[model samples]
Target chain A: MKKNRLGEFQELVLMTVIVLQDDAYGVEIQRDLEERLKKRLSVGAIQTALKRMVEKGFLTSEFGEATQKRGGKRKRIYSATPYAHQVLREMRDLRAQLWDAMPRLGTSQA
Target chain B: MKKNRLGEFQELVLMTVIVLQDDAYGVEIQRDLEERLKKRLSVGAIQTALKRMVEKGFLTSEFGEATQKRGGKRKRIYSATPYAHQVLREMRDLRAQLWDAMPRLGTSQA
Candidate 1:
């Protein structure tokens, strides 16, 4: 498998997990992504991305404490793995390098 | 087609084209990616990505001046389309926002 490569949606979902920190979970992630992107997202789409990232070792999830408000249902909290953070940093650096290399006209035209 | 979404390899190739500016072409891009990434790349792989991005409208290509070194073969120079630049900026901003929201410890562990 190709390692350290993230699809756009996977990157977005992984970043959201990091943003939400301890509260990162399915419902919350979907809501937050919708709010931040100003676009509607299906729960299934979010779950698919979450599952794929988990398999890629970019994320880890653990069930939260059971809540009485939800009739003993536990939300699975997600967190970014070290690998995910490393990839994100490397990606940012690569883009910065490219941007720095761009000629004045290249950016101006864009 | 998903708009404004770039795969990891596609993103790398697009960035390389921007870095090379007017000089961007298949051979130069492949060489640059290999050097920066410290990984060997096949011409076929690079061509495939270039073709894909061109079809996606993230890139545009034009034939450069025929060179004596190439025996009259014109190198097809690649450039980032405005859409590509826009997508790159959006991706950067999204990542920055997520990184900002991360707790200090989140980055520390990574």
Candidate 2:
């Protein structure tokens, strides 16, 4: 559980990062997740999760080239590592298996 | 999100309950999850999760008839409510959307 666990929020954040791609940064990730999850996410919460994920080898980040758009500040762009992709796939497959194993609703069997 | 949110563990537990049907009790749920997830889970953790889910209206439980098989002790059996099924379906759909939206691996469009 400790080695390869992805929390619900962490999974959602990682998905948002993968979907955002080149524009995967703090503000953009927060916005995308908020829009998709329909929840008001605190920037602090997203940033913390991003930091933890980067440390966990699930994601990698690099500073973009400095631009004059905001006084030459470089944005930290995030990307999902191959490891993250594998874990995500495993989760999806496991979930699918569980769903398939479920009996039809209203059919109770011990 | 607060109104209809399912944590990853909660979702998994709920799915297991549906799959295990009438046999969805504390010990069985824990064993099934540990086997499928390949992680050691504490009895306390599983029980706490079940309690929370019940409070959240995602599950319902009942005490099974006392049996001599377990020294006349009744097991508390859990079942997923309609709301749980709906939330699980929504989560599956949402994950599929994210997976689809992702760019093909190694073909970095960014």
Candidate 3:
């Protein structure tokens, strides 16, 4: 897991970015996360996690067109890379294998 | 995830203990793990993981009968607890949810 371990927060943020698709900028991501998590989160925290994932190659970011809502500041839109899904799928299957191999809490297999 | 995060090695060791059933001890566990991982690992490493699991209440250990093969030293046999399965199941389901929610690469879901 260490070779490509995605921190839990990073995993969540990456998934949110995928779900958000074209709308995955910092403020929007924070809003979506807060809504889903049923709690408030600092924009700074979400941005920090997003930045780390971009550095880790699990994500890529580009500046979007400046918007009037944000006073002419372009948002840094984020997207999950194929490499992100590749590592995620690997971990998912690894976990599935472990689950399937288990003797399931005392059945005939045990 | 942090509430009950199991280290990857610890998860493997716990599963191996359950799979080994009554035969789980330091030597047997190390052998099984080495076979599965196809790499040499120290007995001390296995024991350290086992002891930590015991402390965490994920495992229980008892001394078996002394054997002349090991110069009358008793073998400490280990068994996974229900709590171990509980946490493993939670992590498994969590991963499954993430994998399912993911839009498959280049799919319509994306």
Candidate 4:
């Protein structure tokens, strides 16, 4: 496997996980995605995507103590591995490079 | 299905499709991601990811005329759906909003 490999959704999830820090979990991730992205994401879709990322070694999850927030159900908190960060860095750099190469085509630059 | 939905890699791939315009295809998409992203992306991984995106209604592909590039093997060309573009726009807006919310902490601007 490549040292820095990630699916796009996985990258976004990882970024959200980093933003959420210790509070990162299924519900929070879902909430952040919806609120921040102005889009709706199904719990099943998020869970399935999270599971795939975990299997790909881009993410790690552990159970958290039951909380009243979920009727005492343990929330599986997720965090990005160092490898995940590395992949995200590369992706960002690549995107930034392309953006840099583009000519300013809008009045926003003026 | 959501009106706009996309994974991260799917977003990147779709962006490349838009950038590549009429020339977008498997090998070119893989090349752009690898070269622009400075990341190694296996052909199989790219192909598989593209297949999934196509199934998810994020993309559409068509068989292209074989070129000297890869003998007579048809290259499956890909293009973003209007829905894909909408999803990308939403994702970009969301990310930009987050970036905008952050206080400037770097000296690069000064």
Best by DockQ: 2
The local distance difference test score of model 4 is: 0.73
- The top-ranked prediction according to TM-score is 2
Roughly what TM-score does model 2 have, to 2 decimal places?
Answer: 0.88
lDDT of 2 by residue, A1-110 (tens): 34666889899899989888899999889998888777799999999999999888999999988767857578899999999999998998999899889986657743
Candidate 2 contains a number of clashing pairs equal to 0
Candidate 3 C-alpha lDDT tens digits along B1-110: 23454776787788889878888999999998787767799989999999899988899999998877847678899998888888777656655555565556667753
lDDT at residue B55 of model 2 (Cα atoms): 89
Two-chain DockQ for model 4: 0.25
Q: Flag regions of model 1 displaced more than 4 Å.
A: A70-72, A106-110, B1-4, B70-72, B106-110
> Model 3 residue A60 lDDT?
95
Across A1-110, the per-residue lDDT of candidate 4 in tens digits comes to: 54445666666777788777778899888998788767788898788878888888888999988887747788899987777667765766666565454334355642
Question: What lDDT is obtained when candidate 2 is compared to the true structure?
Answer: 0.87
Error of 4 at B52 (Å): 12
TM-score of 3: 0.67
Error of 2 at B13 (Å): 0.7
Please report, as a residue range, the 10-residue window in candidate 2 chain A with the lowest summed lDDT.
A101-110
Name the candidate, 2 or 3, with the larger lDDT value: 2
lDDT of 2 by residue, B1-110 (tens): 35566778888888999899989999889999999989899999889889999989999999998777747578999998888888887788888888888887768653
Model 4 bad stretches (over 4 Å): A2-5, A68-70, A107-110, B1-34, B37-90, B96-110
Interface RMSD of each: 1.6, 1.0, 3.4, 3.5
lDDT for position A10 in model 1: 84
- Candidate 2 lDDT for residue A110: 39
- Candidate-wise lDDT, in order: 0.85, 0.87, 0.80, 0.73
